[model samples]
Target: MKKRITASLASVLALSTLVACSQAPAGGGEVKSGGEKKEAPAEKVKLSVWHNFSGDDLRAKAVRAQIEKFQKDHPDIELDAQAIPPDGYRQRVKTVAAANEMPDVFFAHAGTGIKEYFDGGLLQPITPLVNKHPEWKNNFMEGALEALSFNNEVYAVPINASVTSLFFYNKSLFEKHGVAVPKTWDELMAAIKTFKEKGVTPISLGNKAAWLAQSSILSSLADRVTGTDWFLKAAKQDGAKFTDPEFVQALTYFKGLADAGAFQQGFNSLDNTQMEQYFIQGKAAMMIDGAWALTNMAATGTKEQLDQVEVTVLPSVPGGKGDPNSLSGGAGGGLAISKKLSGKKLEAAYELIYTVSGPEGMKAVAESNSVVNYKVDVDPTKVTSLFLKAYNLTKQVKFTPVYDAYLSSQGAEAINNGLQELLLGGKPEDIAKKLQDAQAKSLGK
Candidate 1:
């Protein structure tokens, strides 16, 4: 998994070396001139941060408030923040890393995304920090800390956790067509057929944004059929082959949906925002998305829109390995400090993570209809039904696949691209073959 992500990030940042370069070792793990270690001065240091969620109105406001509060408490530390869109954030981070100008503190993913940076020696190990600070350790969610650790070293903090569920059908459309919410793949197909008969598209998908396709559909299907551990292992080729029955089943199911016209025309050109707009405006009957969509659905949807929407996990395939209740999700979205900053900068960085993911920050996240891994005392009244639903579903889900979690940089791109190709025109076995070939080549197997 690590190798796949490395390749993916490398391609994403091919032209931008600034962020990727900091990954290069300047000297040995020890200080030079060397009888004794040389320490850099730590007083009144300023650290820079880069994040993709910076411009999101509510998220931005929450982050800014946290920063302001942190600044007030730690007057000696200064932080500079830059926000970019999530789509372009990876390249920008790579540019900074390549140029050896990484932020002292920045937000990064916990899975393959951070593994590359950690392997490159560009991220600081936070295990000792978490160990020494018992308060931070005690408050984290179960399994949260373990997921963020690579090779026994903690490198990132989880700010939010999400499990991907299959969201489909407008209640109005379903009733109008007399179609029921599906509990199984066959039932879902029936529902799609009903929508098609009523001149409404069954499912709206935007694969133009590559990752969305994997996150929304492929990942969810993998969860339903293979369970999380196997899925993760498969992506890493961890004794699981691309040609495994579960992989074949997922590919076949995905293609069957496409062939049956489950999606609208020009799906290849559609992206997430457009897909969301299609569903929100009632142009489509259903969508497969994450819990984050709730905030948007509520904010932009009308009373009619609100009435028509419902959330649920994807239907199970007949005779699939995983239970219908098992879903896809992980402590994937989170924050981490860059290895670059120290002294006051380091202290300030930790403060930022603590504030956003801690009690006060988590409350804001819950209010925003998001999920986090904090165990702080909560006022149940403060959380929305969306979170409540997601929370319950997450507990039922015992696994998350490796394609999203374990594969290295290179593997992620190959698998995602392979899936896209299968959707476009490639055969399932051909797709699997390509994946096997790519893994063999990339991993030098």
Candidate 2:
């Protein structure tokens, strides 16, 4: 949620293409015999699509490419694609919903946020569409479709699956410092200490935008200590609480990392892109970030540099309730159609969704070093090594949903702000209590 935002020339090109096609000849059929003219064919259906792939990166390019392909395949349909900045995207969608101006199809997350829209009767149920196309639906990974569903109705179609708790480290730096990849909490601390003593930044974190640290680090730490069951119970206000000892211990553990100077100086003032720069420039030994970073690294870093980077789940914690290999991950987000759509407009919107998140689109997503929910065939040589390593690590781990994705908006904000305070010497108990209060209020308890 507003951790960072990126805009690219590809979005501009997409908009330009949409405008250019608006001037093209209409798709209707017309015939004239003698002096009388036959009836004209139906006008092309124009569908407005809003998405957050505004950056000029591989992900954005992949989306644009898919849009072009869709237009080529269906010339009778015109897509008015608008690339919104990610930072304000959620609010923008909310504003549009308030004004009853939601587009025919729009990009949205697959969890609590989307549930809000569904509850408001603003989103279209896509279960029937999925059911009609078994071949298309079967391409998705297990539970993916279900994850995007609410109250037995599917609201969104998952495009990608993202793991946020990955520890991406510079292999060369580890070798230079004589530090092995850590396997346990103790080993991880020792590694941090070693890097610190050698005058190296152990981790690169940027929390000024807030969600970065929560999504990338604390979510995994919480799972390691209290496990996902407790958190889910707490979210539902079903006896579990954030102020429970196990949850507090998780906050304490995260504070310990900050106390040990694991993160770079002024980390809270920097943004995620800046943190990436620190890792890319070798100023920091490792970075805790989402799977999206791998795609960025593949696009910007050299082959050797990309090869030197490796990813792994957070190290095991002693006495932890969760599986040592459990990772904070889930379906990142997906496209949803408006409830008002029907007939040809609905068909065109469904086609757009399928083309972007289906087998063909997923192949492009995989080749760009990103993971997709769709089980598409991809050439191994086309995928980056970083992606392969990350993919393998995910396969070996159990997945815990990302905090913000599962929590109510207010509860999520509370944790994000509370964790930011932890970096400033806030006490674990105090932070835990604050989160508990927020969660209680969100649940109206």
Candidate 3:
């Protein structure tokens, strides 16, 4: 039940084993004094951790900063960390967990994504850890830990909030082309036409990984046509189905965008970073992406360039049952600790997790324009204008569902792969039927 996140981790910068220092070494028993067990002598220990903060971008720098601070805080502990790319990191975590060979800690998705680790006893509930730092736990936005919990026990701590469907348009380009911001389906098409005719890509997409179409665009676009109510019903296979006319119509509309050359050429072959570069270079007029992209812009683009961008949801579609001002969103994932240690070593792992994802950690990353699950107090003047715009919009807009966040992995895979085909001129009807079948099969269980 992995989420098809558009942004990928490049390398794990922090994670690994915490050699138990408080406990007797290896197989040694605790030293006894007169009539009681005396505490073991403290020794320098090595803690291993794994993460993927390979980039020097603001987000990565923020993460690295937290790690360094954690090391400094625990001078007696040496961190043995390994870096792994995003896709490889996901697979690696799975492989190790399935074999009961996980590191002391690692990064992963939440919600249904983390359920496997919890159910398999591969993870430890952090309720006690949070309890140990009540102030830190209280700083989380409402319901942030629910995504990383099972049976009311949280297993991980999420760092960011993922509002996945946003349209980031270059205001300068709109003014230069004399095109008004799109407000309806027709206006969107018209704007696309105007930009395409002007030799500019109307939208820049990086979908080589195939999850972008589902996560960034259709999640909200389809809601604009199908409404959140119908999507929930369809996902549950209760009173609605994806093959219904509304869903097919949504697919048709998504395909129309592709057919109109709304996206830059070879979008299906591009990754998000490349697409971000393409958009920042002004080769495209707009890019539909998630909230995390705010950090990318803050890290890579100049102040002037960011100031020319406006963050907002996609325009309304005609006859859409969804709120025109809504976006597809849900709680995002975070890092988890392995259930392989006890006593002081386990305590060290929990402390390390908090050091990297708690209040202080979140506040550090927020400087990079990250919209985190933790409530961070930042000077408005210090944040990038790009993030400020998106942050403000989140307050005004309702959050709709992000498909992969709720759908069964099979159902999500269906839509994700189907959209890739749909964009290449495949039949919308065919894709809708496939989606319905997958959802029905998944929910039937």
Cα-based lDDT for every prediction: 0.71, 0.84, 0.82
lDDT of 3 by residue, 1-445 (tens): 1333322321121111222344344446564443235556578776778887767667777887888888898988878777676667778878878788988877768656777778788888888988888888888766678778888777888867778888999989999999999989999999999999999999999999888889999999999998989998888888998889999999999999999989887889999889988887778999999987887776678877878889888999998999999878756677788887777778788888888888788887777777776667766877877787787777667778888887889989999999999999999999999988987887783
- Residues 1-445, model 2: lDDT tens digits: 2333324566777888896555444544343444234556668998999999888877778887898899899989877998998889999999989998898899888778788788888888888878877898887776676667987877777777867888899999999999999989899899999999999999999888899889989888889888888988888889799889998899889999999999988988998888887897788888999988887777668887788888888888899998778778888778998999999999998888888887788788777777776666668797887888887777667788788887888888888998889898999999888878988898899
Alpha-carbon TM-score of each model against the true structure: 0.81, 0.88, 0.82
Quote the positional error of residue 3 for candidate 3 in Å.
90
Q: In model 2, state the lDDT of residue 292.
A: 82
For model 2 the TM-score comes to: 0.88
Least well predicted 10-residue stretch by lDDT in candidate 3: 10-19
**Candidate scoring better on TM-score of 2 and 3:** 2
Residue 208 of model 1 has an lDDT of 87
Which rank order by lDDT, best down to worst?
2, 3, 1
TM-score winner between candidates 1 and 2: 2
Flag regions of model 2 displaced more than 4 Å.
1-37
Error at 165, model 3, angstroms: 2.1
Question: Which candidate would rank higher by lDDT, 1 or 2?
Answer: 2
Global fold similarity of model 3 (TM-score): 0.82
RMSD of every candidate to native, in Å, equals: 17.2, 15.0, 15.4
* Residue 282, model 1, lDDT: 84
